[model samples]
Target: MSATPAPNASQSDAFAQLLRGSLLPTAVVGLGCVVVGLFSSPKAAWSAAVGAVIVLFFFSLTLLVMKRTADLAPTTTMMVVMATYTVKVLVLGVAMFALRDVSWASGYAIGVSITVCAVVWLFFEMRAYKRLRIFAYDPDGAASLETPAPKHDAAPTDREPRDEP
Candidate 1:
């Protein structure tokens, strides 16, 4: 099968910009969680860090999928997006369950950190999307509907007289 064409520079740049926008807020929240956890316990601190890492991991995975699918057909892209989200959610759930009773991890701290970081990332992403200037339809790029289709040598002439019953 032929590979999908690579995304244009602008499309790539938009994804990069989205990542950049989300990164700072998420990092700040993660750092704050770490600081708060530090005062609570070492386990808490570690859990907070793990939560941050998890959020970042999922975010990166999403970005990677989006980049790879950027040039694909819309239906294919949507399928990719849905599949990725489903996998990400399942993995996250499994990880959380497995780590729930771990001795060195504070469940409360991890939960809080994950929640905060996820929220921060989502808001940043939403804002970035809102600020993006890309248009769904570009008038300048559209072909004129009035343009005549090219005639092929083998095609039957439209002007040929036809007998009407």
Candidate 2:
């Protein structure tokens, strides 16, 4: 069987829109945090930048991975997601442990920036998802992700009805 193309940020697909919405706000807030952190101290600035980058990378990777796995079996998707989560947690733990004694990074700045950026990203993503017309359960059938949805005004079908019947 031929494989479908993986979803990307370049597409006008639902996940792509959500990805854009999430990334934009996270980036803006991340920058703001960095600027504010700079005003506080160099250490704080570095911490804030690191935190923002962490949040952006993790969230984007999750979304993109999910998009890539959209066509996979549910069990396979779950396994992939679990593996991803485990790896992320382990990486984060190791990084934090390695950086615990860094003289130029403030934990407070990092924590605050991570929280703010994650919140902003999640909020915008939720908003974008809410605005999409994706139907989870259609009585007719499920819609295809690789193709545009059928337009209502395209043409009349036999199902219209018999006037005398």
Candidate 3:
């Protein structure tokens, strides 16, 4: 009944790996959006860059919190992630709303592009999480948790009594 030790991040491509791997893709996506923005509207490109920064900041914060509190309850973890996501979206939405009178089409495009990049990053992270499944426990008492029950070849207790004439 012994449990295997969790894999080390160093031994596997994990959270850090995903973040590192995403850098090039993120930059490529951002550059493409900027180029598109310049052609579509330079103002939109600038707005998209700002939106991307906000989104990345919020996403990184969520990851940091999750990494720190991996042992916490699932509800608590989801709440933190959801709360941060809501804040980020709200802030971005408010910014776009405030600039509604301006070239909103570009702004919206930029915002959506940044969001797409964030979603891409999230997909990689989720993949890594599925593979990692990191967990923490008291190493000392860990053995106790895995202790097996004593084995016995005892007969069934509920067996009916044999009748003798």
Report, for every candidate in turn, its global Cα lDDT versus the true structure. Answer: 0.86, 0.80, 0.66
Name the best candidate (by lDDT): 1
Give the per-residue lDDT of model 3 (tens digit) for 1-165.
997766544433354665665555666776677777777677878766766666566666666665655557889878877887788778767765665556444657655766777776677667766666555766568667888888787866987899989
**Taking the tens digit of each residue's C-alpha lDDT, what string does model 1 give over 1-165?**
997765487788889889988988899889999999999998999999999889888977798899889899999999999999888778767777777788889888888888788889989988987788777777686666567887786967779798999
TM per prediction = 0.77, 0.68, 0.58
Name the lDDT of candidate 3. 0.66
**Candidate 2 clashing pairs, residues 3+ apart or interchain:** none
List the candidates ranked by lDDT, beginning with the highest. 1, 2, 3
TM-score pick, better of 2 and 3: 2
Error of 1 at 11 (Å): 0.6
Q: Which stretches of candidate 2 lie over 4 Å from their true place?
A: 1-12, 89-100, 139-165
Q: Which candidate's TM-score is highest?
A: 1
Report, for all candidates in order, the number of backbone clashes: 0, 0, 0
Positional deviation of residue 95's Cα in model 1 after best superposition, in angstroms? 2.2
Residue 165 miss distance in model 2 (angstroms): 53
